[model samples]
Target: MNPALPLARLGRATLDALAAIGQVTLFALSALSHLVRPPFYLREFGQQVMQVGWFSLPVVGMTALFTGGALALQIYAGGARFNAEAVVPQIVAIGMARELGPVMAGLMVAARVASSIAAELGTMKVTEQIDALTTLSTHPVKYLAVPRLLAATLAMPVLVAVADAIGIMGGWLVGTTRLGFNSAAYLKNTTDFLQAWDIGSGLVKGAVFGFIVALMGCWFGMNSARGAQGVGRATKGAVVAASVLILAANYVLTELFFSA
Candidate 1:
């Protein structure tokens, strides 16, 4: 008897998804256009840079450190079976610099910053504060989205850089104390094996991931539906979308950088 209800719900869900996608596209174009124009919001950008990059340092650092420490232990353990334990330093450096460092940092920032941005903008939309900004002749895209995109894109590499350093330190601690690695010898092995390009490529990947995170957050928020339900939906959607995109982009970048 209620078969029609489920069909109607399916139709409504399809429409909502289409509407959200359209809104996200328009927001991206508007933000892109505004990015090139004047009336730059350095103040806003600085705040976002601090929020997305600086404020995220502790989480990012801790993530990297734990990952590096675990990686060192695992690598050493695995290598020991084959009498290949000497590969630990090289593997650690390569693994962190190539993949884990940027990807983990990106995910952390996406979780922390993306959801917050979506909630903030969704709140503004619901309260008509966005309209107020428009009434005051302020382009919300320029003032909000562009700054966030720039901040995340520019700051992610720096975060990854710090993460890389901290990660290496964690490996150093594990290698020297637990793994019976000579401190000086481990240091020399790591430094000698790592190339500058390995680190640089990871930072580049981080920047791209950062852009995706901010873009998804701003897109979802700017296009958020009305009411409390809409805000909650948008916030959750933004985080999920950003996380997926980060992992997807990481894979693409890895292929591009490493494939012959």
Candidate 2:
């Protein structure tokens, strides 16, 4: 009955989505452009480094530890059916490095940092502090997004490294204790299976995911609507979008790196 109207609305929705993506991309480029300019904000960069990297350590460590432990148990149990129990160490190492480590760390940072970015910038926007910066001839992109983006991009690789190490340790503990694996043998199996490429790919994933997460946060934050409700919306939207993007990106990266 309303075929024409529905088709028109569908076209508008597609256009709106495209526009949103374009806005976010433009905003990210603007921030990167500022990063190359003069009068660098070393203090802000240092502060964001602490916030994104140092402050994130505890959560990333614990997540990696528990995930690795669980992976060991699951692999051992699955392998018992075929008398392939010794595969636990290798599987755990590969899984954590190639898949879980970067994805989990990215999602966690998205939850933590994305929300904070949205709230902080949204508040500034609501209170006109952003406008004040504009009036003062200062670029907010430089002042806000550059530091956060650089911090996330640099910090995520470090965080993933810590996660990978701790995750392997967790698996080692579980393999030795619950799975009745000899510690030296377990370590050997892990080392024998994991190549440089596996770990390197994970670190690369970390950097890319970090950029996406921080970019989404800054984009949503800068474009967030006025007032508390708008800020809340931005926060929720950023986290949801970042998490989804991380998983989608992980799959793509995996295919690029490993698929024949």
Candidate 3:
């Protein structure tokens, strides 16, 4: 193996990554611009809000509840080792409000909504429906991408707020029923420990993650290759990209919000 060959391959990969970023950034900007200049599709936007928000509630709630419970148990177990088991309520509230609730909700939405949007749009692309829209004088990005993107961005914060409440309640339930803590005291500790900024930061993270999810789906689908296998790949790529970006963005936002 030639040393120069590996360097060439690394350079190619770096260029490819940069090209992808540029393409995605342009796509997002186009969709955003369309949002303000529209024969506004109120019906499409409403449908997407339901699809991305209301239908996503059950999965987000379930994930938050179970995660909150497990977190409480783990915190209690670890804290017990230090004779600090009483910290369970406070820790769970902070963890769920500041981190787990938003991250888990974002991931769940990425898995469900991103994949669905990619598949739907990919199928439309493969079937020439997008071309039909163009011929009929409708901008596909405005009709399809804007609704989904705007809906997700607006809806995710609401979902995250619900997740945070359910998550805190889950901790309370576990602490009271399984961990031998007084319910009222657990609630008080949680409320006392969780700051308004923590929850607000998580909601902001949720909105960003939602935008990323829809952007990945729309970008991959619109650029999908022309075949069934291509659509499949686009769907997979959308979910993977959305999920990774959510995690990465989560860290960046956390650093900005909480760093000393």
Q: State the lDDT of candidate 2 residue by residue for 1-260, as single tens digits.
A: 88799999999999999998898888888888888998688999899889888998899899999999999999988999999887999999999998888988898888888888878888888888888999998888988889899989999999898889899999999989887899999899899999999899999999988888888888888878988899999889999999998999999999999999
The local distance difference test score of each candidate is 0.92, 0.90, 0.94
Query: Ranking by lDDT, best first?
Result: 3, 1, 2
The model with the greater lDDT, 1 or 3, is 3
Off by over 4 Å in 3: 1-3
The better candidate by TM-score, 2 or 3, is 3
TM-score of every model? Answer: 0.92, 0.96, 0.98
TM-score of 2: 0.96
What is the C-alpha lDDT profile of model 1 across 8-98, one tens digit per residue? 9999999988987787778778888999999999999999999998899999999999999999999999999999998888899988998
Looking at candidate 1, the ten consecutive residues that score lowest on lDDT are 20-29
The C-alpha RMSD of each candidate to the native structure, in angstroms, is 2.4, 1.2, 1.0
Highest lDDT: which candidate?
Answer: 3
Candidate 1, superposed: residue stretches over 4 Å from native: 1-23
